[model samples]
Target chain A: MKKDRHFYWRLFSSTFTLSAFTFGGGYVIVPLMQKRFVKELKWIEEDEMLDLVAIGQSAPGPIAINTSILVGYRMAGIPGALLTVTGTVLPPLIVITIISYFYIAFRDNHLVKALFKGMQAGVAAVIVDVVIEMAARIIRNRRLLAIIVMALSFIAAVLLKINIVIILLFCGILGAYTTLRSKHDARSSPDSGKDESCAEGSGTGGSAGKKEGSD
Target chain B: MIYLQLFWSFFLVGLFSFGGGYASLPLIQEQVLKINSWLTPAEFMDILTISQMTPGPIAINASTFVGTKVAGLPGAVIATAGCVTPSCIIVLTLAVLYYRFKGLDMVQGIIKGLRPAVVALIASAGYSILLTVLFDSDDYTFRLSDLDFIAAGLFAVSLFLLRKFKLNPIYAMLAAGIVGMVIYGFLPSF
Candidate 1:
């Protein structure tokens, strides 16, 4: 009992510290969680970590949140899961609370105003990095089909202002058709759609690795 | 009314927020800014800025900040909880059916389709941010033009430094913050 308790505490602390400082939400948390969970604590193996990334991405919610819950739950079951989520969320809750207060006060301050101007630019760059990185990943590694679908969706949402929900549903059907068409193609082996990335803005997680492992 | 708003904003965002955190923004903007008028367009824009700068999902951050804004301390807790609760329930349900539908072709296709859709959603939100926060088209007033160019350059240079140099994002953000502070001291943002 004591051993388990200590284990849970360590996980809580480690995950808490990690989540606290992780700026940029889901994608940023990837390597950080990899270091702690895969390398330092030896909690999850590398391949499993990748699999978890895929799983967590597909599951729902932010990748970090889902990952925390899975790691926490695996470590100590329900209690462990609760502890992990708490650990991960607590620091942000505290820090953001304070930041929220000061941000409210400082929103109009010249210093903050200047700071956000730069920060906003940084945020855009991060998004650009994500899009570029994914484009390279898919273009070099995946299919031309993925690019076409992405462009179509962009037109649908940006040009149309069609509620994202409707676009998602409509495009979702089209996406499935592509998946089905590719599935039985003789040249394509199994696992072609297994390594998707949710954190990097793709909602699914199986395509990249699945394709790669076939070779 | 404020308390009611806290519940409503969260409930609505939580109800519709699918795929991931950024996916929540459009729904949130509609509820908090357009539908209810709880926050002005400027204040709503500020909330987004703060959300990006801080930790956690943007959805969670908005819930906490807006909740706090509308109703104070209790509002923060309640709103955050509300935002997360739906996901918890849904994910738990998802966990049960996870294996049964694991290899379904349709699911894979939906996911594939979602990528483009998700990208579009993000692009749209980014556009909305630009419209609300960056430019004033009617008068053509450059609200923060000087800082805008500097920030864009900073972001581009930092990305180069980050990928080319293999430096960490923390270092980049900190360096940018320091740069902002330096610019604060030197140039008059007035």
Candidate 2:
């Protein structure tokens, strides 16, 4: 019983400290979590960590939170999941709350305004880089369907100004349909070469490309 | 009532915010700026900036910040909870199924389909932010004379550094802010 309590404490603190210190968001925190749990603690295997990250990415919502839930659950079940989530969230909740209180004061400062103006430009550039890299990956995969969906979605968003949720729903349904159809086709034509009807399941899509060429 | 609205808005953001941090920008924009006028365009940009600069996920930071702005500490708590609730539930369910089946072809297919669309959403969001920074307006219409060349130059240079040097985005943002302070704050550019 005592050992179990100590383990829970360690789990919470590790996640809490990681969440508190990591500044680059989900992409940054995820690897750190792997190092701590897989490398440092030796609690989870390297392959298992990779699988957790894949599951985390595939699920909706922030990758950090999703990852935390999975890791915590794997380690200790529902209580551990609850504890790790609270630990993961508390840092940002506290930090942002403090900042929000002083935000009005900061907002009116001339120097602060100029600084934010500069950051806005940088933020824009980063976003553009993300779009380009992500789009490039899809294009490089040589999947016609993926490329067409990407182009159409971009046009829909920029020109037509369609609601984003609707676009996501349409693409998801289309993806599932293509996969199901392709599977069916492959079953009937047993001698057929690898089916290319569905986009390759490069589960590391969009934001997951962060560490691609950086090394 | 306002608290409830904030929860629901962020809940939708959590639900549909696929891909990752930047992809959530449009969903949050839809909620905070379009459906509800809780924040003006400038305020929205500032919140995003703060979110990017801080730790944790941008989605959580933005939700907490917006919640506080709209209501108070309670609002922040509620908004943060709403943002994370979907993640916990969905991930837990997925974890269970994953251990059982070991193969999630259907989920994989859906994610494959969502990938390009998520990229498009991020692009659209970036375009809007670019418009606001360069043209000082979010609308489609802007005069050439109204363009901010300095910000555009910063954007180009930042993009080059990020792509070529693989500079950390936090450092890039900080450098840009320092340059902003030098030119806009101290220099006689006004």
Candidate 3:
């Protein structure tokens, strides 16, 4: 029981410190989490960490929180999940709370306004980089369907001004339909397994490979 | 009632915030700025800036900031809870299903489909922010002469640094802020 308590405390503290220190976003926390959990602590294997990250990325919500939940659950089930999330969220909640108290004074400051104005441009630039990088990966895969979907969705959102929720739902249903149809086709063929693996590889393998290369 | 509204708004943000932090911008923008008018575009941009500079996830930070602005400490707690609730529920359920099924093809396909759309959402969000930064207007009707050349220049340089040199975004933002302080803050005539 004492050992279990220690383990839980470590889990909470690890996530707490990580969440407290890391900046930039969820992606920035990935390698650190891997280093801490997979390398330092040896809590999770390397590949398991990768799979957890993949799942975290694919699911809705913040990748950092999703990842913390997965790691926590894998470590100690629901209680672990709760502890890790609280740890993960507490840092920002505290920091932002303190900042919020000073926000009114900050807002009226001329220098602060100027600073945020500049930071706004930087933020926009970073988002553009993200778009370019993501789009390039899809285009690099040479998947015609992926390319078309990318273009069409961009058009729908920018030109037609459609709600993003509608766009995501439409694409998700379309994706499932196409995948099911392709599976049906493969099932009737002689080499079904190979085809399915190939499709899966092309869909996710690109990002996974890039992540490895970066590491 | 306001607390409930804050929770529900952030809950929806938590539920549909796929792709990552940048992708969630549009959804949060729609909820806070468009629907509820809780924040102006400039304030929204500041929230994004603060989120980037702070620790933890952007969604969480943004929620806390917005919530506090809307309803103080209790509001911040409730809004943050709302943002995290979907993540906990969805991730825990997925964790169970993943261990049981190993790999689900339908989930993979849905993710595959969501990728491109996520890119689109991020791009659209960036486009709007870019407009606000450069033209000082979120609307599309700004004249060419209305463009802020200094901001445009800073954006281009920052993009170049991020892509070519792989500079950390936090540093880029800091550099931009210092530059803005010197130029816009000190020299109003230039």
- Which runs in model 2 stand beyond 4 Å of their true positions? A1-3, A191-215, B187-190
In candidate 1, clashing pairs total 12
Clashing pairs counted in every model: 12, 0, 0
Candidate 2 at residue B156, lDDT?
Answer: 92
Candidate 1 yields a Cα-based lDDT of 0.63
- What ranking emerges by TM-score with the best candidate at the front? 3, 2, 1
Local distance difference test scores for all models: 0.63, 0.85, 0.85
Estimated TM-score for each candidate:
0.73, 0.91, 0.91
| Winner by DockQ | 3
* lDDT by residue for model 2 (A1-215), tens: 23367889999999999999988587889999999998998777676678889999999998888899988887777888999999999999999999988987778788888888989898888888888888899999999989999999989988898999999999999989988997788788964445332223233331132232112
Question: Model 1: residues >4 Å from true position, as ranges?
Answer: A1-4, A34-49, A135-145, A177-215, B1-31, B34-53, B97-107, B131-189
Residue-level lDDT tens digits of model 3 in A49-148:
7878888988899988999999898777788899999999999999999987887677878888788888888888888888888889988999898889
Reference interface contacts recovered per candidate: 0.42, 0.77, 0.77
The order of the candidates by DockQ, greatest first, is: 3, 2, 1
DockQ of structure 2:
0.58
Candidate 1 lDDT, B1-190, residue by residue in tens? 6666677667657655555656676677767765677776666666666666678877777777777777787888777776665555654444334422434345546666666556556656655555443342211134555335555567667778766876665566667666865675468534
